[model samples]
Target: MRTAYSVETVRAAERSLMARLAEGALMQRAAAGLAAACAQLLRRVYGSRLVLLVGSGDNGGDALYAGARLARRGAGVTAVLLAPERTHQGGLAALRGAGGTVVPGGPESVGAAEEAIRRADLVVDGIVGIGGKGGLRPDAARLAALVGQSRAAVVAVDLPSGVEADTGEVLGPAVRADLTVTFGTHKPALLIDPAREYAGSVRLVDIGLELPGQAELEALQHADVAALLPLPQAESDKYRRGVVGIAAGSARYPGAAVLAVSGALRGGAGAVRYVGPAGEAVIARFPETLVSDTGPAKAGRVQAWVVGPGVGDDAATVAEVLGADVPVLVDADGLRLADRDTVRGRGAPTVMTPHAGEAAALLGVSREEVEGARLAAVRELAARYRATVLLKGSTTLVADAGGGPVLVNATGTPWLATAGSGDVLSGLSGSLLASGLSARDAAGAAAYLHGLAGRYAADGAPAGAHDVANAVPEAWRDVRG
Candidate 1:
């Protein structure tokens, strides 16, 4: 599990670690890590021009010290100091002592910085950190614009400035970095998004901050999710494992039935029973699936059920699925049609999967609001509906009804945004549920696997739903092995 602590927790941890060390020790450790990362980036590009956008805080100190390291290593290094008087004194002295030049921020400074950035092999962003509030100041904003417009690889010190370190909220404009080398533990913003989106790739730099309190947020990496995946024993048979009942697809959208069943087939379920009008189409695509035209109650001994996903706006189907005594996964059209109380009152585990748009509809908010505060949105949904909620998108988040550990799925690709992809995820998650995983684990594990399958199917090329489904077994093997 990748843990993310809140900003206050991080600060306290930093204080604890700093108190044990001599003055400048923590900063030196951070600077060394930053400098090493810069060297690696420089080696890849095969050039020596490096520019540091310095602010007035310790973040700037980190950059200036790093700049000194590069200057000593045969690289041309320069610093564009946003606050000349308030610059980190030790860092400034180190840079100047190492033959690095510090330029004031202005039109001249901007011109020089932009020119250097255009020709530079890498740019280091130190404009802001956990101490910063709101968006970038005008000068820092202008510098960020230049960095964004430049072709040089940009590495952020700590985090991309202007992003809320606590909430992953971009209050206004922010820097988009190619790599972010964060000190100590991971910040919630680095793992969640709109801030996470700005943070292209995150690398944690251990400064030995002894953080306080439990993690505010968490993400499941490959190994973490791999451990959570369901595995069967040699004595296990189809009925003995688990059976997943799929109540999806109406006559209007029969393709949803096919896609949802396809996902369940690879979801680690012992067997899948399809119930509803689209059973014919589901059977046509997956003849191995046990098909029935009966209601969810007559679907016959299912360990779990997947509801919604192209089932149209049928109130009856929603009612039947909700009334069942097993764990139910609500998705797609079911999100709009189902009753929250009925779902909650079922007394069984319930998992709701909704993309930003669908989640917005469920919460009576705008999609932008949901995207801006995805962590809060998912948590709120889980609390409100008293069910496990999975908000699917670039960064998929799974939260339990009681506000337990929230798991973020980081394996998604833009290619997985195609239609019917969500249906597959719902089926896969339902299968995990049938296989006896908790709602939160099932949802998170399914998202991780679904994303891996999507990436494998695309393989850097464009892929459709069928390609994603076809890659599921391979993805499972890769994880289980």
Candidate 2:
């Protein structure tokens, strides 16, 4: 699994490592990695026009030192010092010694810096450090605009400046980089959305810092997911393999039931028991499904239940499903009808999957608020509902009840925004729950598989919900291999 640490954790690790090393050893490590990454991107570093936007923080120092390295290699390096007096003096001296030119970029003067950025082959953004908060100052914002207008490829030091490293919130003008070379460990901003979008591609440079405790956020790799996937034994039967109960769909919206069933069938569940008013529609589509007009309790021997999707105003069915002794996966309309106290008081595990809008409604907040603070929102929902909560979007997040690391999935494409995608995810996640994975594991692994399936289905063009469900086997094979 790829891991991400919070700003506080990263700082502690950095301090611990710095205390045991020479004064300039840690900074040198970061500078060397930064320079190497820039070199590779430039391809032909020698004679290239490089412009470094240096601020007052260590990020600027990193850029200054890196510029010195490039200068020695015969590249024409220019450092635009945003805070000349506060700049790293040692790094500034090193740049001058290596034939790099320095220019002032104070409030009164910026013409020289603007011209350098426009003419440069590459632009290095060290304008703001990780600890920098809110947004860019007026002067920095002006420089950011110049970089945007220029055709030069931009590389950000540590992370894209002007984003909240821990919360992944981009409040104001932030640097958009083609690549970000981060030191020590990955920050939440590099993994989560909004801010993650600013950091085009990320490269981690090991500075040998030992981070204590678990990661605040984690993204499951293929190997981690493969280990969690269930495989059948020789003695396994339809019952032994696991049966998933899907209490979804209604008279008005039967397609939701069919789509949910479509995903469950391909999600490694041996039998799917679908109970609702949409039985006929589900039967017409997936004949393999065991259909019932009865409620979830009468569905007969299901390992887990998936309630919601298109069962609009069906409060009775949602209540029945929540009362079941087995694990339950609640979503869609169910997220609206199911009682909060019932979900929180359940004896068995409960998985609540919601998109940003649905989550906002649950928390009594606006959609924008939930989307902007996804990590906090998901965590709060998990605790409030006493269930594992999966927030679905550009980057799906799975958070367990109480504490521990939250799992993040980024395998999806923009094509996954089609109708019934969340329904498909709900059913798939329910199937995993039936297969005996914990709420967190089932939700996380299902997201991983669902995202991969979406990618395979879409390829490049748009794909429907059915296309995504049909691609599950491809994702499974890819994970196993």
Candidate 3:
């Protein structure tokens, strides 16, 4: 798993490590790593033009020191000091000694900074660090805007300036980097959205700081997914493994039932017992499915239930599923139809999957608000509903009501956004829940597989919902391998 810590946790870890090391030793280690990554990006270091956007804090010191290292290797480096008086003296001296030129920041030197940015091969953004709040100041913001006009590749130190490291919020102007070289640990901003979009490709540099406690967010890697996957044992049978009850679709949208059943079949569930008005369509598509037009109560014994994929205007079915003793996954129309009191009163685990628009509706906020502040939205929903919420978007986040690290799905293609795709995901996750995974685990694992399947199905081309559902087994095998 790729774990990310909050700004407070990273700062505490840095302080702990700094106290044990020599004054300049820690900076030197960070600078060395930064220089190495720059060299690799530049390919040919000699005679290359490097511009360092130096600010007032240790972040600026890191850039200055790294620039000095590059200058020693015959690269022409310039350090544009945003705060001349407060700049790191040791880093400034090192840069000057290594033949790097320094330019003052502000209105007087704005033209000079713009010229340097224009002519640079690479620009190192050290204007702000993890502790930075809101956005860049005028002097830095002006220079940041120029970066987009230039052809130069921008590399940020630690994180892009002007983005909140903890919340991933971009209040104002922020630096967009081609690559970000982060030290010690990954910050939540690097993994979460709006800010994540600014950080193009991230490279972690180990500065030898040991982080403690639980991570704020985690992205499951292949190994982590493989471990979470429910593989059948030697004596396993359909009934012994688990049964998933899917209460989806209506006479109006029978395709939703077919697609959900398609996904459930590949979810490692022992048997799929489906209930609702689209039973005929589901049986026709997947003959193995135990179809019933009755309510969830008459759907036989099921370990878990996935309700409300395409059950339009069928609020009763959603309410019935919530009352079940087993875990239940609420999605699509169900999110709007299910009673909050009934959901909160349920003793069994409940997972709510909502896209930004749906999530916005649930929270009584605008879609823009939910999309802009995804971390806050997901957490708030989970807490308010007293359930696990899987906020699906560019970055899929699964948060539990218990307040632990949110699971971020790092897989999938943009092509996954199609009609009925979310239905497939709902069914797959519900099956995992039936297979005995916790609400959080089931949601996270299902998202991981669903995303991977989308990638496999779409392969740089447009893929339909059925293609995504059909590719689930391949995604599972790939994870296992």
Candidate 4:
């Protein structure tokens, strides 16, 4: 798992490292890493031109020092000082000592800088960092706007200028970076949305900062995800391994049941038992699924239950499923009918997966609000329902109740947004739950594998629901390998 520290945590860690290092050691380390990254951007560094958008803080100091390094390597480097008088003296001196020059800042100066940027291979953004309050200052904002329209590749120093280092919220215009070289630890903004969208690619540079407490947010790596997956044992039987019971669909919408069963069959569960009016359709599509029209109460025993994909607003079915004493996954129409008190009181672990539209309904907010700050929305949902919550979108985020690390899913193609994809995800996650994975792990792994399956199904072309479902086994095999 990749750990993300909040701005406050980053500040604390910086302080700890600062105490142990010599004067200006931390900045030097940051500058050196920044310089290396910039050098890589300019393939033939010897004759390439580099532009630095210098501000009035340590961020500018980093850019200046990096410019000095580039100048030393025979790259022509220029620093456009946003705050001429207040710029870091040490950094300025270092740049001049290495044959780099600093220029004034204004519309005419910005035009000259833009010309330099257009001719240069890369632009180093040092306009702001963790100390920034809201967006870019007007002058900085204008320069960033021009850079966005330029051909030069933009590299951010520490964090992207104009992006909230803490909340991942963009108060106003923000610089779009092709790559961001961060220091000490990962900032929450780098992993979350809005700000994350601006950060094209992120690379961490170790500054030896010691952080305390738990990570506010995180993303699971391939190995970490593999470890969380359920592996069948030799002695395990269908019953012993785990059984997943799904209560989904109605005669009106039978596809939901089929899609849900499709995912459940490919998920980690040893067996999947389907109970609903769509049993005939599910069985028609997937002959392996065990079918029953009995209520959830009489669906026999199951290690976990997945309720409501197309069951609609049927109050009766919702109540019966929620009353079960096992891990449960609630999705689609089920979200609308859920009660916080009942979900909170359930003895078993509950995972709620909702798209932005559904989440908007549950939170009494607009879909725009949820999409703008997906991390915050997921965390809020988890805390509100007192259950594990998975918010699905461009970035799928899973958050657990009582404050735990939030996992962000970075995989998946635009094609995964097709119809019934979510149903497949719900069933897959329910199967993992039956197989005894925690709600957080089940949701995250499901999202990851579902995306992989979608990619396989599409292969760069448009695909139908069944295509994605059919690719699950192959995706699973690849992940296992």
**Candidate 4 TM-score versus the reference:** 0.97
Residues 339-410 of candidate 2: C-alpha lDDT, one tens digit per residue? 999999999999999999999999999999988888999999999999999999999999999779999999
- Which stretch of 10 consecutive residues in model 3 shows the poorest summed lDDT? 291-300
Per-model TM-score versus the true fold: 0.96, 0.99, 0.99, 0.97
Q: Which residue segments of model 1 deviate by more than 4 Å?
A: 44-47
Off by over 4 Å in 3: none
Q: How many steric overlaps does candidate 4 have?
A: 0
Assess candidate 3 and give its TM-score to the true structure. 0.99
Candidate 1, 205: how far from true, in Å?
1.4
lDDT of each: 0.89, 0.93, 0.93, 0.88
The residue pairs that clash in candidate 4, if any, are none
- lDDT (tens digit, per residue) of candidate 3 on 267-384: 9899999998888889888999999877889879999999998899899899999999999999998999999999888999999999999999999999999998999999999999
What digit string (tens of lDDT, one per residue) describes model 4 on residues 215-295? 888887777778878888999888887999999998888999999998998888989999999988988888888888878
Model 4 ranges off by over 4 Å: none
Would you list the rank order by lDDT, best first? 3, 2, 1, 4
lDDT for 233 (candidate 3): 95
Model 2 clashing-pair count: 0
Q: After superposition, how far is residue 143 of candidate 2 from its true place, in Å?
A: 0.6
The stretch of ten residues in a row with the least summed lDDT in candidate 2 is: 105-114
